[model samples]
Target: MQTCEVETIIQAAMPEADIDVSGEECNFTVAIISERFEGQNLMQRQKGVLALFEEPLKTGRLHALTIKAFTPAQYAEMQNTFLVQLES
Candidate 1:
């Protein structure tokens, strides 16, 4: 997926989120910071975010994906070192 599309999708789902999307073409790396993730675990966070691209992923419109999601506080503490990892 394109960077703008990836970013837009995430932004739509989590309007208050701070999202960073990188990589090229169909492969991407996304870091999402939101208060919505405050009480969610890593898998829960992954599910919620990945759901936004279910159709694209299934249709092959989106290829590889690397997602790291965290609450604002967590991101502040681990900005240089991700606390979790989820890949698709």
Candidate 2:
């Protein structure tokens, strides 16, 4: 429900991941970075995270979830691009 709680759940599922969660009570956006996603396809990567919150999703405690998953290298690249855009 809360950002920290969502973050904790993702962290539990992927202990080595770096997770950032944001949004209101029942809706959330999550960004997860980990080597575990390296060879996976996009659907697989998204499914991996969605599976962690099955119960909440089923119970409607979590209404909406938007997820972005990437490997560490991808995350770094994205961050660099964002920074460049800000400077432009």
Candidate 3:
């Protein structure tokens, strides 16, 4: 599927989210940061996002989807961790 279509699907569900979709054809990696994930566990967050692409995934329009979903604070922390590791 096209990247824009994948992005549009996710964005429609989480209007307040910051969504990033990369890769091509039927494979994609998605990173979503939103306040909506604040109290949810990792499974809950990932499941909710994956659910948005269920139809596409089932139909093979999306073959592989790697999801990285986080709250704003979590994304900030993850970025810091990666930066620290690079510096070390």
lDDT of 3 by residue, 1-88 (tens): 9989989998999999999999999999999999999999989988998898889989998999898889999999999999999999
TM-score of each: 0.86, 0.90, 0.89
Clash pairs, model 2 backbone: none
Error of 2 at 24 (Å): 1.1
Looking at candidate 1, the ten consecutive residues that score lowest on lDDT are 79-88
Superior candidate under lDDT, 1 versus 2: 2
**Candidate 2 structure quality by residue, lDDT tens digits, 1-88:** 8999999998888899988888999999998899999999999998888998999999999999999999999989999999999999
lDDT at residue 51 of model 3 (Cα atoms): 92
User: What's the true lDDT of residue 27 in model 3?
Assistant: 95
Candidate closer to the true structure by lDDT (higher is better), 1 or 3 = 3
Question: Candidate 1's residue-wise lDDT over 1-86, tens digit each?
Answer: 78999999999889999999999988999999899999899999999988999999999999988999989998787744554433
Error of 3 at 37 (Å): 0.8
* Cand. 3 Cα-lDDT: 0.92
